[model samples]
Target: MKFLKNKITGITIVLIVILVALSPWIIWHFKPDRHLDVLVFDKTVPQNNYREHKGFIWLLNSFKYTKLNGDKYGLLDYFGFFPEPNYKYKIKPLPKDLSKYDLLYVTDTYGVYDRDFYGTSKNIEGERSQKIYGGTQSSEISSIKSALENSNKSKTLIVEFNSLASPTDTKVQKEMDQLLGLKWSGWIGREFKTLNKNNEEIPRWVFRNYRKQYGKEWNFTGSGYVFVKNDDTLMILEKRKDTTKDMTFKFSPKGQEDFGIKREVGYYYWFDIMEKVNNTESIADYTFFLTESGKDKFKKFGIPTSFPAITESKIKNHITYYFSGDYADKGEFPVVYQAVGLPKINSLLISDYGNTDSFFWKIYAPVMQKILDNTYEKKSSETKTASIN
Candidate 1:
């Protein structure tokens, strides 16, 4: 009977310790919602592709942001995620007025592809199909422009990669470039764990284009990087021969202070090669550890050895940010917005390379959380000043 009593007492003490340790998280989980007014626009939310904007959605939930005139936690103006009941309205148009939104987030403008729409196997397909749908519409770009130009309050704009890439109209893309201080070089690239022809992970078009341009059969089979321009110009950099190490996100000292990220993180996905225009500031850069031969290859193609990973610009009272890579893509994982210390713990456990979750938890979420918090603080201060006046 005494042993039983001691066991029960020990269990109770353990529970108490755990609860004490999680007290801060428990309080945070139940903090009152801030009710931030924001907009999210993504044209590539296909049925099976939830990762495109999953990290963004998780952030929204973390802040308890709500849809306009609604209590829902997510977007009412999203597109391409669901099958359109009416074919005439397949493409979703932007709200007529966006001046009321404190923040505008354009996560993707790449839109739906033939492979995604038709459910084609990810393996190589026939010559590029012309059946892609949706893109950054001219009217949508006009709406964003009007909001920036006419809004009475300070507005913040955030855009991710592929916003000015293929499927988006060139004229509309150029307009966005001017607004956000960007100049797209028309090249997109990604790292492949293996360059073997049988690797289903590699896109078929990349292999086909290289073979056609050089009139040589696909021969190399090793880890490498593949780059393709809008005009089908192909460049491949094999590991060891061209690059000594994987690419990493090298943050500027200012970026580290601003975003509260102190460590370099690996980025192994699609990214664009673009130049910063106007008064844009680079917050971080994609550092490619290329060999001398790799440098020669990039120089031959008129590409730089390194380029901006994140850029920021200020227009009047409005601020805009351009993420040059898939910064918001958090692969399949359960949301844990209420768990405060999980990201810190996870960052310590996960490796920095080839892990999407690590990048999301260690880099993407922290930077975005800092941005949202700072934007809200500034907005609140402005509100208080306006009220006083």
Candidate 2:
């Protein structure tokens, strides 16, 4: 009798400890303060990467609940979360319903993988899969554009990261111009000048030497911030520094020139796309401050850099148009678009654990936070207008 009692007590104690260990999760799961329905579409959601992805999602989710009043938030994962819980997490596969959700969060890489999987795989047929996987197809781009434009509900917002590829062969420069009537220089022969902490101009040659040591071509031109807008409203904020220099023309300079060569310097431009949006203007109204040390480092290294930090008042002002780079180089240059804004979305894009802690995050998160806040405000205003009518 005594042995049986002892065994029962041990089992009970273990059960109580297990419950205590899992208490936080249980509380978080069942006692959400607000209800928010968010959809995440990514192919690697079930892998270890999902944990990091969830960190961002949960950050946003917690912020949403704290800022907005909601008791229930519905989350849908397309690729699913790893360490698959014993309990279902309301997972939905492709072709599932999306109309009921309040917001959709999509990563650009997810779209690319989906296109290759469902669109290229012969196992599936018809245009349905193709439509879902918007690729370099006109129809797909148009479809996505239409969907975004139509999602005007005050409660719905689309937070997209690193997903702004031209749907067809049309470059983003051309597409942005056509879609928003904003003229932008291509990524070449641009110049970027750095300033010291005292706001004094750093010698241009300093950047020149840095570019050389980094094996970058010397063709650089002018570098600065490019602002775009429609009807006096700021739509896009592009802060970039470019370098353009001339070197001796090499044999087959037209094709053999490398990004590091002076001849190629005139042919290629490096750019980083900081923030893009529609309907809002004037990034100046927001408090703008880039880490002074980072700026100083760029100057010390003679690297071209641009930082967009503005006062809250500047954000409300209207911005008309902006330009970045435009140069012609051999096709070997790293795709400027691929390199730009990489750090801004690294948690979702890069597989390496080291990238998350990289400098990109340090500089980008604050900027993204400001942009997201602006977007949320804009969405709220639009919703109010619709509701009033």
Candidate 3:
């Protein structure tokens, strides 16, 4: 009897250990695959590198959203990055009938540039990616409009930064702007940790363009913010002179509740300054903690100290979200997404202060999850109502 009892105790311990070890995967499986008919359009794909939409793809996998192609997650559904024998780089045409898709997520329309294709390190295009497969094509814009119209205002469209920026024809851009009720300021800016050329963070074209325009050498050094207009106008805000602190991305009360964001997060990346038009609501904004000097400089250039980071507009039944920053551009966290608790652990281990991925985990992930969840529930409810009718 004693020997049998001891064996039972050992077996119980082993079983508990196994269960604990498999908990993350088990937890992951319990979450239902929402099976959303999502269409992700990322045109910036160069080679097999999926940096532009990597984080978004991971979210799709995490949410278990079935793409329009019937697969859980695959590059096949993307309108861009399709390589062929004749053309190694070119954005594949979008489908004309997009009404079938429940969600149209445009992560990066910036497209593959010459530098991106050949690689920046090679100096092939002299720092200019030079729009190759980027910018919103007329056909693509038309399809998006068709989708919105055909869906009877039920479709959701989410467009991220650089979608309406330079390289995209003004006429084509105006179509989207008019449709979505947004006005692009024709300027994009980003923060730099250092202006030292040795760091190699500053793009070569920036220096070249600055020199060409001003006919002077690049002399400024140290951390700063750089802004460039569509017409090639360049302005720099050095750290001590312009900004007292780094920018913070904050969500409005409505946004905080809607997106389930707990608090503000550090924002360090490319962001465009935009003015809301046609009753568009600013859901979130980037607050640049600028010095008096910085304020004057921005004012002189007709730039606002604080600009909309995320904007939302509702057209009839259709809802649109414009993320004025490169929101979806981030490194993929494979293991972090696989396990349930890994994200929390990872967040605790790393400092969110300067880290870019922290924003993905803290702000982007939860918000995206909420969007997917709400959309799934709403769609499911509509289906049930339709069946009953």
> What's the lDDT for residue 5 in model 1?
100
- Cα error, residue 372 of model 1, in Å, equals 0.9
The predicted structure with the larger lDDT, 1 or 3, is 3
Q: Give a tens-digit lDDT track for model 3, residues 1-389.
A: 99999999999999999999999889887875667888889887765657777788877886677755556786556877654443365556778889788788898887766665665433442377466667888888888887887675266889888789877899988888887788888899988888876656677888889999889999887888889999999989998788887888989877877876657778888999888887998888888888898988888889988888888888667788888888788755665465665555556675667868777777777777777777787788788888899
Residue 382, candidate 2: Cα error in Å is 9.4
Q: Choose the strongest candidate by lDDT.
A: 3
Model 3 / residue 386 / CA error / Å: 0.8
Native-vs-model 3 lDDT? 0.79
Task: Evaluate residue 26 in candidate 1 and report its C-alpha lDDT on the 0 to 100 scale.
Answer: 90
Cα lDDT over the full model 1: 0.78
TM-score of each: 0.90, 0.35, 0.90
Model 1, runs deviating above 4 Å: 1-12, 21-25, 67-72, 75-81, 84-89, 120-127
Model 3 regions lying over 4 Å from their true place: 1-18, 68-70, 83-87, 119-126, 341-345
- Alpha-carbon local distance difference test for all models: 0.78, 0.33, 0.79
Q: Where in model 2 is the C-alpha error above 4 Å? A: 1-32, 43-48, 64-76, 79-99, 110-140, 155-161, 165-168, 171-271, 274-389
